[model samples]
Target: MELHHKLRRDPSWHPNACNICGQLGHQAVNCTNGTINWRQIYGDEAFTIKPPVFWSEMADKQKKKEVDVKELARRAREYARMQCQAQGIDYDEMIRGAQVFQHAPEQKPQLPVTSQQNGGSAGGAVKKEAPEGDLPEGWAVARDAQQRVYYWHKKTQKVQWDKPTKDTPVS
Candidate 1:
């Protein structure tokens, strides 16, 4: 019997109506007709098919993101070797000292032997070297191209723009 006819015949007819299949006698939540096959009912227009993926291309992209430790170490070693060559410093010594700045010895003007023999002094214009006692152990002062003094710590491989005090080191 139709739902309206049954409802007309009996006013107390409270049969559960399923909203999914639209049938009488079970609620929509309790309906057990499984999933609705949209493709079966609506044909190929139900959903679009995606193009097949190339796994090799995806794998290559994933591999590019990962780093090889050995390759990185080799590159780092090569860079350090290049830096040592460019700076004219010993790579082994630099590696051992860790951060030590081995400054190239400054060339000083030599007084002529005749001037020394004549007992004439080189004037009072002698440039005094920066005192090492002010700096901490394994630290030294160096001048840049502008002659501005910068402190270097060999062991820590650190540089500071300000002057280091005897009691405390400048960061």
Candidate 2:
């Protein structure tokens, strides 16, 4: 039997609608109202028999999102590299320091604060702490050959690999 003949019409036999042009009677794949014709619209080289109106829309959105994310990530990496170079430190070392911050808890880690030798201000005696848990994923605490510990700071937009001081060696 023919496919249409074997099928029985129901009270809700509403025809398929086209997602692109918002037309009824025929689905987007079989639409012939000139709104979307795969062969003519995309050309023979890009034409495909398989309908991908929904999938293509989703894929396009995903591709755009990925592009935006990659651009942002590239900018951040470049800024980090530049900051590390200015401080006479390895860029990779700074990245490793960011890892330590990533795995730590929400609360900022406490380090000893020393008063300014110039006797600037009492507030200068307290060292401001970095914000907690804002680093990229897959980061870990690592040190360079100099055994310096890296730390991430939002204010400077840098990952600092602090050298061991005379009072606090092996930081």
Candidate 3:
């Protein structure tokens, strides 16, 4: 039998054609035919091709209403309060914690370098600065208050603060 006949006989065989341009080989949905002939589709002779309006252009043309910042904030607080009550948590504490993170300044720490001549390790014994405040579960110490440093932990799970000391060996 022929290759096309064999393919047709296959259970998974599907016809491929560009729906927009009426072209073969490619699927219909992803047709790159930019020219949308509305007249051809609708059979309306009055219809003509017009320049496509981008999402941004359409948004720009729309009349925007001024938003009240204070009102929006009040509504957001009310919503948050309801959510917190549903989840059984302090709303004020959650807001305060969020504010602390929002207002906190960004800090980056420099790694300590060791001198080879001083008999020190090649990559200096880097001492990790202690965390400033007791953050909530899953939250990490972004900035240390004592040495004024920042650290990032990719894990979203909560870590035990009072675990093994720095002297403890890792298995």
Candidate 4:
């Protein structure tokens, strides 16, 4: 009992418990077990106990991003131009001109019940004419789904067509 008391009283003896290994006699560094890689083991908690990361080590995740979409698109466009050049195709000539998309015609509103009883529509209302258009220029003969033949007039933008005889079946 005296010897045990003397050992406890010795200067080298550590009264407090070790945070690592939990041994009482020595400091954590003097532990018999190999040094713990707290960063690997405890992860985020390691930062609380250890020296912090250097200022130079900080980074923006966006700077490390894999690809720029605009850059990729520009590269792809260049590649297409190169391929067109290789094939002896004129890039400008190969491109068909852009066309405006036609929207569905707006529906005419129904006459009010009171207006119908009055025997006339509103004074401001007027019927709209459909746009005058025909088959594309240079197209000789146009065929409808029913196989009716059409001749387009470039000047008048009119389609002059022959109606199929009733006896001639469309398939």
Q: In lDDT terms, which candidate is top?
A: 1
For all predicted structures, in order, the TM-scores are 0.24, 0.23, 0.29, 0.23
**By TM-score, who's the top model here?**
3
Candidate 1, which segments miss by more than 4 Å at Cα?
Answer: 1-60, 99-171
Stretch of 10 with least lDDT, candidate 1: 118-127
Candidates in order have lDDT scores of 0.62, 0.53, 0.54, 0.50
Per-model tally of clashing residue pairs: 2, 0, 0, 0
Q: What ranges in model 3 sit over 4 Å off?
A: 1-60, 65-74, 113-171
| Cα lDDT over the full model 3 | 0.54
Which window of ten consecutive residues has the lowest lDDT sum in model 2? 162-171
What residue pairs are clashing in model 4? none
In model 2, the Cα lDDT at residue 147 comes to 32
Residue-level lDDT of model 2, residues 1-171, one tens digit each, is 235622532324444445434466655565565455676766876644676569889989888777577888999999978887898889887678889989987965545444343134344333234333544433233433333334433344444443222343221
Over 1-171, each residue of candidate 3 has an lDDT whose tens digit, in order, gives 446645434344443444445456754334456365544566753545677889987777673655779999999989989999999999999888999999999877765545442124244443356554554333445433333233333353433333234443333
How many Å off is the CA of 101 in candidate 4? 9.3
Per residue, candidate 4 scores C-alpha lDDT tens digits across 19-135 of 345567755444455366545666766556566775555455445765889999989878878998999987665554312223445675564344333224344332233223443
Candidate 4 lDDT score at position 142: 53
Segments in model 2 whose C-alpha atoms lie over 4 Å from true places: 1-67, 106-171
